[model samples]
Target: MADNNLWHETLHDHFGQYFAVDNVLYHEKTDHQDLIIFENAAFGRVMALDGVVQTTERDEFIYHEMMTHVPLMAHGQAKHVLIIGGGDGAMLREVSRHRTIETITMVEIDAGVVSFCRQYLPNHNAGAYDDPRFTLVIDDGVNFVNQTTQTFDVIISDCNRPYWSRREPVHLGLLRRLQTLPESRRHFCGPKRGLLSAAG
Candidate 1:
């Protein structure tokens, strides 16, 4: 009877504290990545990879909207759009907002990133993945740009900095290929691509 009573007391003490806190950091690990999802907290959830914040529970829209809309509005009428390296699909979401866009082609190197964003970062990408107007081509942006004859009214490069030794080569190749498309008005954005002077 004494042991039973002690067990009951311990259970009450332990389980009782669980409900007191409304939120906690739940650590989750997978074969491909490790993530910490903020549960019942202000930020809801975020995917952290290699100690870097990949996406957050809130304010993703603000970033996406600002990145895409500013240039799009400046162009006035963007019927066709091309996105390079934005596997997150948030840019596509903002791009689709413009009614003038007839087609949007997104070139993503990693399909896994897109899949992960669709599943885990739904708040950021939402249902933009399912939109018919958004066409995803799982290919290198440099190669895709070089081979394609299709021109875009606006081209948004969402790639990260060129860390690879061949990055400049790829960038030059893409730029050279883009120059051949006389109809398409090119607009280069993002960190690495933005560094090049207009004369270069």
Candidate 2:
């Protein structure tokens, strides 16, 4: 419940954010988490995962751009990228902007989230799902990273908050693994909220 029948996202003891809900766009539960997408008067559309606000439609570019570009730019000659957990496809959309990058493989834990966003929050991903250079892998990011024999020039993790996902160790372990890539210049991009999660 929210003021004027709007939708609310509260992060218990820390903070609360609200959106004017034009309508409940989509709501469903996938194997890994509950997903919600709704039209907001201010943000256009919003997506939340397991009650935690993940990303809003309006400011997504800031996150996506920095997440995709900074690392790619820093690594200058990156040809391959491995994105972990960007189920919404926004990061994929940003990454596809670079024509020099030949391939992008995105690993997400929930296919339902990808399916849900593609249908309802259609513009959020901006058709990145169907890009020829993109590949989607539905699996746990940690497991994917641990098991994959292939290496990438850049690795981006577009996951939600660690506290919300109960996977802090997995995220940290992935970072530790990134440090050990022996033969390649590996660059990493992950959530900014990870700093807060790490502190806790």
Best by the TM-score measure: 2
Question: Model 2 segments beyond 4 Å from truth?
Answer: 1-4, 12-14, 162-170, 179-200
Model 1 segments more than 4 A misplaced: 1-42, 48-51, 162-173, 180-200
Rate residue 65 of model 1 by lDDT: 77
Q: Which numbered prediction scores highest in lDDT against the true structure?
A: 2
lDDT of 1 at 13: 25
Number of clashing residue pairs, candidate 1:
0
Can you write out model 1's per-residue Cα lDDT over 1-200, one digit (the tens) per residue? 01221111122324411111133344455444454434324445554433334445665666677778887777666777888766667788888888778888998876766776676667666677777788999888888876776766677776543232344644466668665655443433222232221111
What residue pairs clash in candidate 2, if any at all? none
TM-scores for all candidates: the values are 0.63, 0.83
Q: Each candidate: how many clashes?
A: 0, 0
Q: What are the Cα lDDT values of the candidates?
A: 0.59, 0.74
lDDT tens digits, residue span 18-128, model 2: 777787778787888878887787887888887777788888887778878887887777777888888888888888889998888999888898888888777767888
